[model samples]
Target: MALPPRPTPNLGWSLEEPRNEGNSLSVVERRMLERGKKEHSETTLATTRALQIAEQCQEMASSTLIEVQRQGHALDKVEHGLDAVEQDVKEAGRLIKFMRRWCCFQILCCCDCFDPDASMDKSRQRRVRMRAQEEAAMAEGQREFHLAQQAAVLRMANKGTDSAYNGNDAKARSELFAANIRRKTSSREGEALPGLGYGLPDDDQHELQRETQLQDANIDRIGTTVENLRLMSLDLQGELESQAPQVDRLGDRTHVVHDNLTVLAKSARRV
Candidate 1:
């Protein structure tokens, strides 16, 4: 019973152990940790948004690159087609030129079966004939001119001869008249003149010499005129001969050219 009363007394004065304050977090520290976790969650959301925008830009760039490639291919095809068409046009032009040249060559060579007189167009044939005639006329005119010149030379010589003959005839007449007067005087005076002898009168001798010279000159002029006329005739003949062949050849060539031109025109029309 005494022990129990002692224990009750100690209960009121209870000896409790010493309490130590250790290094431990408080309510304020716990609040700071919660705020930091909220900030981290916001930063993560922002990073996710930035990554999404970058991916969208990359997709657009890829699509644009593909479209550019397609456009480039189309342009290349167009250029190639143009090049091929140009080459075809060039070949066509070359063929046309070749055909034209061939036709010209045929014309120049006078291809067969084409009659200048019948097959050729009338106007062209007429022109060719007219050209030939003109050449002939020119040759004739040249011959006539030469002949006229020769005739003029002959006329000049003849005129000179005639003048000489007339002069000589007058001198002869004077001499005869003087001799007759002297004879009559000698007979009337019943005396002969000393100088009066049986000789030709000076006028008669001069007349005879002049007549001979005039005759010779006239003969020479006639011979020269004849020779010149002969030469002129030869020249005219030669000209005719030379020009005739040329005219014929030119006519044939012209006909051939007309035929070839006709054929070429038809060909061009077809093309």
Candidate 2:
């Protein structure tokens, strides 16, 4: 009777059986966990695929940048060649001009020796004027040829400008594509997956997000590089355009010197 009375005073004692919660899970919870694992695996797989694609894009961009640089170098070589041609033309013009002046002086001396008091007849003077007019016309033609060459160079420069614009547009598109990928990744990160407790570990998810962020940074760097290359192309095109007129002038002067030599040769033969 005393023992029964003591048991009646134990108010904190539990009557229900203990459950093995640590060793067993409900069927629904197990299925939910399985589903969460499946979804997480799929998400991880998709993220990996996206990363692979991003890497591929980066590689492609790198190769494209290399090609653009090569083209720029080729253009630089062409510009140097043009400079050489211009220099050679100038030297040729100077030599021709000097030869023409020397020939004219010799022809005058010969004429003075042959006919000291003989004045030029009207026909001879008219022919001389006509020959001078012809020389002027030849110089004009030479100028026109030089202008045509300048125009051709301008056209080429315009084409290069257009190509640069196209590259810019492509770069914009690439940036937009990178932005969309980042947006999608960020949105996915914000979403709370169902039964996340049974899904990928928090550390794993954070690592994946870090990798995605790194990829995004790489893409941004690539876009910046492409933009810089495009700017360089534009600058080169502008430089080409600016220099075209000077080259044209040099060409015109060369042709005029050549014409003067031809006229001097004819006058020398006549004398």
lDDT of each: 0.44, 0.49
Compared with the true structure, what per-residue lDDT tens digits does model 2 show for residues 39-139? 65566566556655644554454344444444444444444445444544444444454455456665575554454223332144464567557656665
Q: Superposing all C-alpha atoms, what RMSD in Å does each candidate have to the true structure?
A: 65.1, 14.7
Best by TM-score: 2
lDDT of 1 by residue, 1-271 (tens): 3554433454454354333244233345435544654554455555455545544443443344334333433443443444344444444444565555556655655533443332333344465567557656665665565454344334322332222222235533543454454445434443333343224345433444444444343344344333333333443354456555655665565565556556655667765
Top candidate (lDDT)? 2
Would you list the clashing residue pairs of candidate 1?
none
Work out the TM-score per prediction.
0.30, 0.37
Q: Candidate 2 — worst ten consecutive residues by lDDT sum?
A: 155-164
User: In model 1, where do residues sit more than 4 Å from their true spots?
Assistant: 1-24, 99-270
Residue 88, candidate 2: how far off, in angstroms?
1.3
